[model samples]
Target: MKKTINWKFTLILLTVGFMTAVQYNSMKNPKERDTRDIWAVRHELAVEKQLHSELLSEIRELDKTIFTYKSLNDENTGKALTETVDKLYSQAGMTNIQGTGIIIKVKPSAESEAFGIPVTDVSPDLLTRFVNEINRFKGLILEIDGKRFTTLSSIRDINGITTVNGLNVSTPPVSMKIISPSFKDSEKLYSYLAASTIHDDFYIDNLILEVGKPERFVEIHGSPEMFENQFLKELPKGE
Candidate 1:
């Protein structure tokens, strides 16, 4: 009888231990899944950004051809030419956007300063992920440190400096202006960004991301140099 009782107790202990392990694994698997998903999204966005840049370049070329032909020969050219130019400028991020929007600022974290850890350049990887996430959340006309974020805009690291649209944003207190479609949209984006783990990501890099309240007249400056297809001028007419 004693032997049987001891065997039953041992079996119960093994069962409980196995159940605990299974529960722990089940809880941990979702975190792994989330990490994989984030990375997969980042990879997809990188590929898509490249494809988008190529496609937009081609589209701009076609538009230039159409514009040249229509402007040179069309009888009712005023309206059509104006519309075409506007569309081209908008797509090229050359037209200033003024409307309701949100501002995001990145600066050195207080904790890092308190801990005597010197602030470092913002990680390109983290910035890319943050930008992609903002785009997904309906952020339009995004300007980072006064540089317009376009399809052709490149954000990368050069000698430990974070370059955005050929401008260095390696320093702290980098400001990002996001012009949304409307006040409601801007508010929604602000809220979404406020609750995002993006802040945590920046914190890991010794920075803090601040999402400001949505406000009116948030202007995003544009660049005339955004579309530099001047070679289109050399193309022969009617070809």
Candidate 2:
């Protein structure tokens, strides 16, 4: 009777252990699957972005060709040719963009926890300071959190949160894309940020800077038309 009782207890223990392992495996498998799905989504998004950039470039080239033909014929409307080109480039976020640029990624500091410091959230002041620093180096075409910076775009602090171009920065590792016509132009921005990484600008805010190499292609996306804020002013009278 004692031997039978012991054998039954051992069997039950084995069964419970096996069930627990299966449950753990089941939970882990879904997490892995979710990770794969997330990666796939990111890959799709990048591909679509590249396609859109190509299409925009082609459209701009066609428009330039048409404008050039008008100018060669000395058309009156050609007088605004230069102005129109500038407007198109501004709208496309490609003004004076002769070459590629660097992408600076700012992430939450990893060692903050180890040092018993908590500064996980990115502050508006940090974003503004970063923008100012890059601009100081003549970094053209500044974009933060995928929102291209225009003359009207700004970083604002509201209710203890940071908003860039009126959008909340709810994620870690904010990306800043900067384009310059000269490699040296982008390089200056890159070098400044690289050197600043070791400075207190990042340490005080608990941030990590990752300045990527000069990419061959960098297309900063503009805001949608819905985001346009119309300023009220009297229009200039047409002659």
Give lDDT: candidate 1, residue 34: 49
Q: What clash pairs does model 2 have?
A: none
Q: Give the count of colliding residue pairs in each prediction.
A: 0, 0
lDDT by residue for model 1 (127-151), tens: 8998888877533788888888887
> Considering every candidate listed, which one attains the maximal lDDT?
1
Task: Give the poorly placed runs of model 1, Cα more than 4 Å off.
Answer: 1-73, 224-226, 234-239
Model 2: per-residue Cα lDDT over 174-239, one tens digit each: 787888777777777677777774446766777777789887688777665443438966678883
lDDT of each: 0.84, 0.72
Instruction: Return the lDDT, model 2, position 154.
Output: 76
